[model samples]
Target: MQSTSNYLWLLSDILGQGATASVFKARRKQTGDHYAVKVFNHISYLRPYEVQMREFEMLRKLNHKNIVKLFGVEELGSTKQKVLVMEYCAGGSLLNVLEKSENAFGLSELEFLIVMECVVAGMNQLRENGVVHRDIKPGNIMRVVGEEGQSVYKLTDFGAARVLEDDEQFMSLYGTEEYLHPDMYERAVLHKPQTKKYGVTVDLWSIGVTFYQAASGRLPFIPFGGPRKNKEMMHKITTEKPKGMIAGVQHRENGPVEWSEELPVTCRLSEGLKLLLVPILANILEADQSRCWGFDQFFAEANDILHRTVIHIFSLQQAVIHKVYIHSYNTINVFMDAISQQTNIPAPGHELIYEGHSLELDLVQQVNVVPKTTEERPIILVSKDPMTPIGITYKEPDIPMFPPKFDLINDANLAKVVTSAVHQLLRITNSLMKCQDFILRGVYWMLAILKEECRKTTQQVTALNVKLNFCKDTWMIIQKINSLLPQMNLTEVGDVHVKLQSTEDFLMSISQNVQKSQKQLDLITAEWSKSNDIHHKDNIIGKVQVLLDKVSAIYHQLKKDRMRMKLQYNEEQIHKFEKIKMGIHAKKVLVLVRDDCVQKYHKLLTSVKDWMRTACDIRKLLGPIGEQVKNLNQNLENCEASLNKTLDHCSSKLHDEEQIVTKLTASTAHLDQKCFEMVIGMKQLKQEMEDISQELQKNNMIIQSGFQEA
Candidate 1:
């Protein structure tokens, strides 16, 4: 067994003790190299030698610039203490530094960048090597003074390190209370913490927490009140938003003291540096793990920042080598100056007669540029591939698949009006064609006659501000004649009233449908007023005029129907008078006249009912057609827009494809030139070698001839 004095001389002093091992300050017996030695008690205490060996194997594999280096391990037979030797950091852990240096590291921009790069680089290497230092905290980070001006940081404590390459479960009370993630805390609370199958990303998250604390001078998360406040604080770390209050507002009103606010930065940094640090801190402290930047991305960004800093500091390539300047502008101002000096294809709706073929030239696009100085701008030119066949198919853009129009008419009331009008027209037309009975034929003819009369009335009604007084006066005159000539009647008044009421109700039922149709027409007119299609505007205008004429015809028809019905009333009155005036029981002409007047009134009512039904039918047809015209206008506009988009997409793609073809052609030309030169060089070299061989042979022949003569 090794003597106690032999190892005692190596230890600086006892530092602390824990459940598994006791820590001591140790030095090399000969070289006086200082180290922290953690000696585990016995084989009984560490029965799972396999687990310890696995951990030791992982720690030994970690050879990062920032990680603490392992020295040696010894087994003391007598004491059965497994001893681990490591390089000692005299400046102590980050926690000790925080306590001594007043809250945190007051690092400047360059210094912070340097430290951050070192930390990220170390962690990145660890992750790449498939190792995870699960227990990352301020207590594990050790700052050591370097030779002269160099400052170095060491990431110590690999006892909690795990190799993720293994499929085995890794569970242990492995991390400090203040650095565990919320998930880790919950698991610990349940006593079923995930000890295995955890990844290196977890280690990265812990490091991010460490960074947040270091930058802001205080922990990002802190608990208000709890028995084990530090443990609660760690749970709050990655979950809660830090209430960054002033220094004086640290304590809670009804709870224990949480953390102080973010301590002020003593490190005077520039705006660029502040911007850089703030985002990093925010990312580090983000609650969502997915949001946090991965170690690879973080290091890449850090490397770029560091390179930019270096460039700024060094200020390389400041002087110009060779300078040339020129200013030129067009001088010609002749009237015959060509516009753009570019070829023009025929506009849309025109045929391009090319190479004996009648080709369609669609004006798919147009562009206008307003340059600052027209004289300075270069003239644009038109170009095309000379080799392409005239009849070759040009590609077009794909059509976008969108929902059907009229699906937008979501109001039930409007839909009913539209559908009802269309269906009623269909029903009326079908009934007129299919009905075969004599009564049905007479009814149909009467309805047709009433519609024709109403059409004449509509002409007068739709005219500018024409009053109904003329029609009223004519009816009054007819009534007076019936009264004076023994043709007036007053019976059947109830039937007249019932027929009038029915006509009024039908009119009322269709009032909204008529108004809706009018509104849609008005909207179309308003849209056209703003902008019109250059080619088809006049055609649409003509169609609108035809529609207006149809409406006027229907309006005049209604007016004529009203006038004819009044005439019919007069005829009915005359017939009733003939019956009542004669008395039929021998000469009661007075009573007969009164009965005739009643019949005339009933006839007027019947005519009005028939006229009203015809008017309703006319309005229904007009309303739906008006709606159809409006819908067609909207669809045309949508088609125009979609066509414009298609044109743009096709143009862009064609331009890109042309550029690729140009590049390929250039490459092919270069290769052809190179091959030609190589062929010429080979011919020249072959001729030169032949000449040399001939000269050598001639010299040998001369020597042999000379020797033979001698």
Candidate 2:
């Protein structure tokens, strides 16, 4: 029965149960090293041996830390099952982190990037080996705790991965529908052959979705109505644009917290974060031919996007107007210059107002902007002048009498500013926490990368070391070879010298390249560490310190303002109390009157006045609420109609352009074919001309010889 107590894998509790196989945690019988064992039943799988053998071959070839390492594969007689042994990943699947922390927290950009780097590295390796992972969902990505107490993510579950051929059979849609590309779903619906080829872009699409959710804690598309309601999800994936969800979404009538404009609750997104994500998402999700990001393009473009900063610029005329967007870092003077260019207002005449006062150009360095995903940073707003095309006017240069206050309203402004500052502090706290967690992950990934590069360098160093010794030996041998000239040919001595020089040059080149690689590694590590600290420690500390002073100043002002407000409130309360006392006195006297009396009438009037005041207070709260609702309605209408119209126009234009491109491509091909034919004919004509010239030259030679004889 091929059963023995000395069997290597001791399968314990089941880790997962899939349709084709059941995975379990195992330990090596001799070594005690932990591993994962996937047992596939012979009956359940089609061509079981073929599949297992193929998987084993691919897994065995893949030597990557990010990819799961295969130890061995075997078949059991009793169970008639194919068992695949793999490295045990203790840190669990990424899905656990995503789903478990739904309420608590989300994967920060640094953390997500760390995971992404691992996944991409693994994928790149697999691609280099001519293999494709059809399934790359979060569940298939797992974290493995290494001996160094560091967690490194790895791409696991190669059951769906296959070696795709260029001119032969390629990948099938053998993955989860949710993570599948829209094209994959379309092909499935069309009942395309399983042998049809699909590119690695399917993985890119899933990566985009994963990135979107990781960064925002929200799905790019709603995970509902899958294949139901006339394949609504499929339709959405194939045709509809991804309508990104709003966080802090509230639904109407105490329903589920789903995102909708009707709910009137909007998630505030940072203008910068939005700008950062839009291009990335466009690369993956946008099905445009020219602008889409290929696999190589992702790595190329990500570094620039990671380092660049985003800023929102505003214009001021009669009212404050938002009009400009700037990328990367710039000083206030530069920003002012940008505004000048955009608004045609000279930088000298116009002043930049922040809070309730003009910003001191000199203190611009102190005003640091920290990029946040949720926070919509309010930049300096231009003052209360109506802007017009011909509205350039020079104001007399004068010193400001009062410093600008930042808030529009006095009491609430201080409270709002203080609240916002507190939120910033909270975000800093969260980011710090995430940084600590992500740093470990980053270190592990960095270590893995270093190990690979250093291994190659070590090999070169070893070779060079050996060659150095060889050169010394060869110098001794060269003297021997020279002496051997008496015994044999000395010509071999030059060959030996030339070979030695070539070897020396080769060693020098390798050494130089290795040094260059080390410098590159230094740059890479520095950049990685800097990116990991997205909100730099110094910046955060400085921001907190600035906000602390601002908050404290506002607190003192708020205290004074509260005192003044309380005094006014107290005076009104005293008047109301006096009126109430009069009303009470009149109420007692009401029994004495029985009929309509002036005192009894005064009580009724007091009751009416109290009701009016309460109503007014209610109105004050609802007034802003009503305005917001009205604006939301207007926005919804305009956005829906305008966006739809714009998209339709763009779609039509794209279609027309595609047709034109197709026509141009065909004409170009025809022209190229004609050019090729003409080139061939021209070559033949040139050959003939050459032959004719050669004959003329021979005849001239003959004629010249005859003349010489005469």
Q: Which candidate is the best by TM-score?
A: 2
lDDT of 2 at 169: 38
lDDT of 1 by residue, 235-294 (tens): 544455453321222246345444333443332233334444555555544445566566
The TM-scores, one per candidate, come to: 0.38, 0.41
Alpha-carbon local distance difference test for all models: 0.42, 0.49
The deviation in Å at residue 364 for candidate 2 is 18
* Model 2 backbone overlap count: 12
**Model 2 TM-score?**
0.41
Q: In candidate 2, what are the lDDT values of residues 1-710, reduced to their tens digit?
A: 12223234434467776767777777666776667877776545675566657677889899998998887776664565667888888777777666532211346444665676687778778868877777777788888766877558898887777876422334456776656666676566545444445666666777776666555444554534323333434434434453433222222333333432111111123333444555666667643323446667776565545444444433322212233344435555665666676556677655443332345565253224423211123334332222332211111111111113322234333343343334333343333333332332323243344435445444534433443443334344334323422333334333444544555565565556545555555554564465445424433334444444444444444445545554465554543343333333323322322332223223323432332233233323332432333343343334323333333343344345445545665677354564454444434433543453354345435533532332
Query: After superposing candidate 2, which stretches have Cα over 4 Å from the reference?
Result: 1-12, 102-105, 146-150, 165-171, 189-197, 223-230, 242-274, 287-291, 303-710
